[model samples]
Target chain A: MRRPISLALAGLLLSASGAAAGPERVAFPAGYQDGFVRYLDVDRPDRKIKRLFYVNPAALETAKAGDPLPDGTVLIMEDHPVELDGEAPRRDAEGRFIATPEVTNVFVMEKQPGWGEAYPADTRNGDWDYAWFDAAGTLKHSDPERYAGCFNCHQSRAGRDFTFTFFKYVEDLKR
Target chain B: MGRCLALAILFSGLASAGQAAEITVGMAAADYTPATVEARVGDRLVFLNDDSVDHNVFVPTAGHAVDLGKQVPGARSELPLGKAGAFEVECVIHPDMHLQVRVVR
Candidate 1:
């Protein structure tokens, strides 16, 4: 028997065609996430980070050795919202969200050799470039002035390769 | 003693019967990797995120409708299949992502 197509289903099908699905606009480093190592999982109540972070292999190794991240190092921060499956948060005993979550956004930080030279000394984040992709893989444009926030946040961790995850990676290196 | 043992055996059987089988559906690069799947009522659906981005798996049907909060890459979410029917699953954030699941008795 043919299942009747309802108005909602019809609407969804129409909307699907116009949805965003390509990362080409921003030149996002596609397929770079494969083989990347997850070094941390953080639950942020204040930010969009519902829970994990992955770092490229060479970048992770560089950070562990207490060296500066070379050009082309990329870090991916995964974003999710808090959700519940029953009484508790929908997560495994280890606190990793176990259910398919609505991925709200993805943030990327990449370093390029000498790229920081173009920025004024006051605004530079070493050679790092930050880009954000919304759930649909569409690039989210941010004001250039606001870009200061990215470098400023990382500046606090200058001793640790300008990244907050450095100390965590140090611990992992020992293990 | 015989009656108590019989009750225990019946409860054990009931528990075993209630156990649900699990199937995994992965969310990857803007879509569900395996867009179609067949399952039975009382089975479980595990939504796995294989994309670098975040994703939410949702179906609109009453009992089958679920809001998989937000899945980071490598994370998983589960839905308990309670009804027998066809469910069209989509990621609300990425309308381009779609999946279809058929559940049987």
Candidate 2:
């Protein structure tokens, strides 16, 4: 009789664990890419410098008032490496890379309730969860530790929903 | 055909060499100039102190810790990013001074 009760308890625990398991991996929201609109272009002299940013409709709605993004807001940035032809990088009149850069990587930030609770005060970026995805939209789990750096940098923008791009998005909305 | 193939190989080698060249970031008053840098495996990061006060670049992350000591005004230090990863660098004395470095292969 004791063995039977123990077996029942184990079964219950297994089911509970399965239910509590959140997304161990998340796929790139491919549909959101097209539905979203590009709001900013950034050029950096550093690695993977040139890129464009896009936002889902929900994020823009909140940008109108310079308010924090609500839960479920998704933002994506596509990084384009400077184009190279053979051994030389193509550069233009102003010394900027000339070719149409192929999409090399995608960075994503999604605001979901209870998402950033796991991070401590020093690294938390509100409710945002960041994922570095490849051009094919496959998630790169190798650098799980680097996510903290993401939050730390964004913390400076805590006033703007922990996002540096919000002010530019708001400027575009005003026009 | 043999000569053309040899040339192709030589050029490819040079291209790879160029890809892994060093990049620089400057430390200025109150902030890291540019504040963010993109680098690659085997590339070296040269940090130049352009401010009046001293600054340091240190990473507390495990397995990737690097402390560049204190850099007085006009001083410089070079660090090679031997691996492909992203690490954050901050001045120990002034927590507000920070730089984000992303290394790719």
TM-score of each: 0.47, 0.53
RMSD of 1: 19.6
State the TM-score of the second chain for every model: 0.76, 0.78
- The C-alpha stretches of model 2 lying farther than 4 A from their native spots are A1-27, A84-101, B1-28, B31-49, B52-105
Q: Least accurate stretch of 10 residues (summed lDDT) in model 1 chain B?
A: B1-10
Candidate 2: tens digits of C-alpha lDDT, residues B1-105: 334434533443354544765555666665875577776667677777777888867654322444566788888776767667776676755767778778777
Docking category for candidate 2? incorrect
Candidate 1 chain A: worst 10 consecutive residues by lDDT?
Answer: A1-10
lDDT of 2 at A35: 91
> Best by DockQ, which number?
2
For model 1, the stretches where C-alpha displacement exceeds 4 angstroms are: A1-26, A32-35, A46-49, A61-64, A85-88, A95-99, A166-171, B1-105
Q: What does candidate 1's lDDT look like per residue over B1-105, in tens digits?
A: 334434533443354444666666666667785678777677777777767898866554323444566678888777766668886776745656778889887
State the fnat of model 1. 0.00
TM-score of structure candidate 1: 0.47
Tens digits of per-residue lDDT, candidate 2, A1-175, equal 4432332232233221232111233348787657987776544333424567788876677655566677778888777776666654454443334325578778888777766554445655786767788878777653445454565566766776776664435653564
Clashes of 1: 13
* Model 2 steric clash pairs: A47-B38
